[model samples]
Target: MNKKTIGRVVKYLKPYIPLIIISLMAAAATTLLSLYVPILAGKAIDLIIAPGIVDLDGISKILIRMIMVILLAALFQWIMNVINNHITYRVVKDIRKKAFDHIQSLPLSYLDTKQYGDFVSRIIADIDQFSDGLLMGFSQFFTGLVMIIGTLCFMFTLNITITLVVVLLTPLSLFVAAFIAKKTYNLFVKQSEKRALLTGMVEEMVGNEKVVQAFSYEDDAIERFDKINDELADVSLKATFFSSLINPSTRFINNLVYAAVGIVGAVFVLKGRITVGQLTCFLSYANQYTKPFNEISGVVTELQNALACAGRVFELIDEEPETPDKENAVVLKDVKGSVMLKDVNFSYVPDKKLIQNLNLLVKPGMRVAIVGPTGCGKSTVINLLMRFYDVNSGSIQVEGNDVRDITRKSLRDNYGMVLQETWLKAASIKENIAYGREATDEEIIAAAKATHAHSFIKRLPNGYDTVLGEDGGSLSQGQKQLLCITRVMLSVPPMLILDEATSSIDTRTELRVQRAFAKLMAGRTSFIVAHRLSTIMEADMILVMKDGNIIEQGNHESLMKLGGFYSDLFNSQYKNV
Candidate 1:
């Protein structure tokens, strides 16, 4: 357990000082009440049995006092529990909200490498375990301490020698608890980490279950899951087993102390050094004193578990977020659609340069096509242009204004994008198309019609109001592409990027969508990244790329006449047909 991380968790409780005070007061009251009950019981025995003649009225009054004390103790315990629960869950809610919001602010580079299930486990499962541990440990720690101290003081008053003996034996319980906790803390940490891995594996497998079935890899998937599940079970067993030993070990020591109190008290009574009533009270106090040792040991185990969970949560909270915009960053306005990349260079990782010294320019209303083989940095160009990533060196400017000088939101606002992968939330079809902005029913239907999505949408049971499943699961690939195109059409950005936008559509349907796109691109600057050579034959400018370098540039007819890389690529596609 990291003290620094655990300290950070305690800092979250600072704002709830008032609630903490109330809970502590309730715990103290409960402990005091419980301690007083034993005293009343001891006194009742003395009042009735110590006298030569039984005092019936006195016994009844003492019994009433003892019952009232016990009842009050139970009530305070319930109140303490209620307050602790409130404090614990409220803290957990705040932590989850902070963690999720922090995730939203984090950079894509950080999120890209993280698994969804791991994130979910940190936000939900880890926080839950942390909260439960805090609730258990916090309430018990306060009450148990008070109960031990009160019992010790009462026992000292009854017999100082016995109290001293009990105090000396008490260190044995602490030594045992600390030793076991040290051994189990690392085990619990391993268990928590394994649980997160198992959750990630399950999520990854289920999310790609279709692929698994298509490839008939069910046995492989099951084997992988079994390996992870077995690791989790092993770690969990070791952690819980070690922690479980704390209670019984402490209990054994406590039973010895109880026996010692009885034997020593009998000797004192035989010597007439202590009265029967006082001996009886010392025995009662001894039981009460030893009970807190067991409670403390149990709470120590819980604290270790809680700290393990809190460490994971704190690690997520402390991740570096996206770099902030400059103080004088300007909002990109009056965009003329002219774009320029001057000596641009970028790489996802250092020493593995993907795009180097890339430079390009396009005038307003130009239809520029970026053609390249896979991994030729075509998508990297789009990513840099949209400021999803910034160039490692050089500049990207829109209308002569450097993109880095402009706010990211304003820079992205001027572009519409459609990728090969379509993303649709579980909402009405109309909502998915009108995503980010409001539009009238007529405008929505018009955009859908323009992209040839209206016909199939109308055939649905609820038409535009029909809800979609994950990524439009019920829709065909062609239908989903059309919807994405419709989304871009409704956006009506000054610049458009279509990256394999209509790859899923049939040739016949693609032609119709292309016509709509031609109309959409009439006055806007456009970038088309395509593998099919025929799609970009009429593009005003075709930049042929090979290994991140532009090897050829011109219209289709000029490129064919040149008979360069572009001609060879164009010929390769037609040679197969």
Candidate 2:
């Protein structure tokens, strides 16, 4: 609806502007040449029928001219269409690329706040709608407008009084189109948005299928899906109803105008105000004007649908992301990897603190381990360390520099992290292990060997060239963890964090992984978030957290000597393992 945004969308056509212009010119030539056929028809009737005499030579020349023009125009139009369609498709590809790239630059909070289905729907389906509008609107609608205008002028020249009356029906056609199109656009927009939610639910359900089956909530999931599907059905029904009415209603109004013009032309001929040939010419032009009117009306409805999609797509691009640092923000550099958390209270939502009045520090190269009950802010330390979310009170510092003052990329680049769930994409083992780092295959193999993954990788049919399934389904959990650790090793960050990396593996695998973890932790500041206390028994420092507060801290032996929370947790938590 906004012209400026429309202009921005049109700017996408800049690269193809010359081709588009040729297409428009071809449309004009076709329309104008085709108009001559009627003129030839009128002349043939006047000379051969009205005069009761035939001049074959003059008639043949007119016939040949019409045929040649028709052939040439058709060929030109066909070529233009071929060229224009290719360009339009390319423009669509570019739009998709830009939208996705911008979406990535947005904060992780953006993904959390928006529905996954809705976001994807905008990029895929919604962008398609806009692409259709741009392609067809430029190629057809503009040319149709020129045809309508040119044909109207020719009609007026043939017979002024009749032309005046025929032009009157145009407003009626416009009114019908405007009213129906407005309503249909609104419906389609709402339908697209709601459909996104339904699609999103489908995606979420499928992704979490394991959780659904494990919890025996299959029936509940089905019921929720049914509700969304039902809503989708209802909205689609209404949207189609409105959209379908567009053509029929517009056509009906146009037919009424066509009928009125035909009747009026006959009356004019009877009154002797116009010749029979001229009356026929006026009749032909009436059809000419109305044909494009119908086309423009149809384009109007199509444009509405495209605009509906535009609205959705624009809404996503316009979303205000979580604020990153300003352009002038400092890059925290040359760190010895000392970390400080001073009186830091945190929450995912208001009035619900996850960590409260927390304070801690770890000197460079110390292995600091955090142990707690399931929800006692153990992983929150890593979150705080990474600055995924800012603290509600107090500040986190890296080597005396406030984390908030540094750019997020710069701060995060200084650390390497391995989480409890090691996510792997579908890629070659070498690429997956090296990931985004600029590491040579030699470096990558070295890192893999360090994490005990190189031997298993080499045993595969393709070795480093073997492709992984989604989330590395082909590999065991411990193997996946080892590869993930190898990936972090390639990054070689100054600080390291392992969040329950070995917690879920088998005892034998855990022991092997523990050795690898120990190797990775040497000569770097490390934070280990663990529930299984045995894994952290060798930690240089242990912090016992209960309900968001650090209740005890010391080396494992000293904490056991104190017989406090750490001792109680160490004795109780890992009994099964």
Tell me the whole-model lDDT of each prediction, alpha carbons only: 0.88, 0.81
Residues 1-577, candidate 2: write the lDDT tens digits.
Answer: 4455566667777887887778777777767776767777776555665455687777888788878878986886687678768877888888788778778777665676778888788899888887888678766787778788778767766777777887787788778777877678767777788778887888888877889899999999999989888887887788778767767877787788778888888888898877777767777887887888777877776777777787777677777766769778788778678998998988777877789888888899899999888889888778878978778889999988888888988898989999988899998898898785877889998888777778889999999999999889668878888888889978888899999877657787678778877877787899988877788889899988988899998999999999988777777866666
Backbone clashes in model 1, listed as residue pairs: none
Measured against the true structure, the TM-scores of the candidates, in listed sequence, are 0.94, 0.92
lDDT at position 40, candidate 2: 76
**What does the lDDT read for residue 449 in candidate 1?**
92
Regions of candidate 1 where Cα sits further than 4 Å from its true position: 50-53, 272-280
The best candidate by TM-score is 1
Residue 87 shift from truth in candidate 2, angstroms: 5.7
- Superposed by TM-score, candidate 1 places the C-alpha of residue 143 at a distance from the truth, in angstroms, of 2.4
Which pairs of residues clash in candidate 2, taking residues 3 or more apart in a chain or in different chains? none
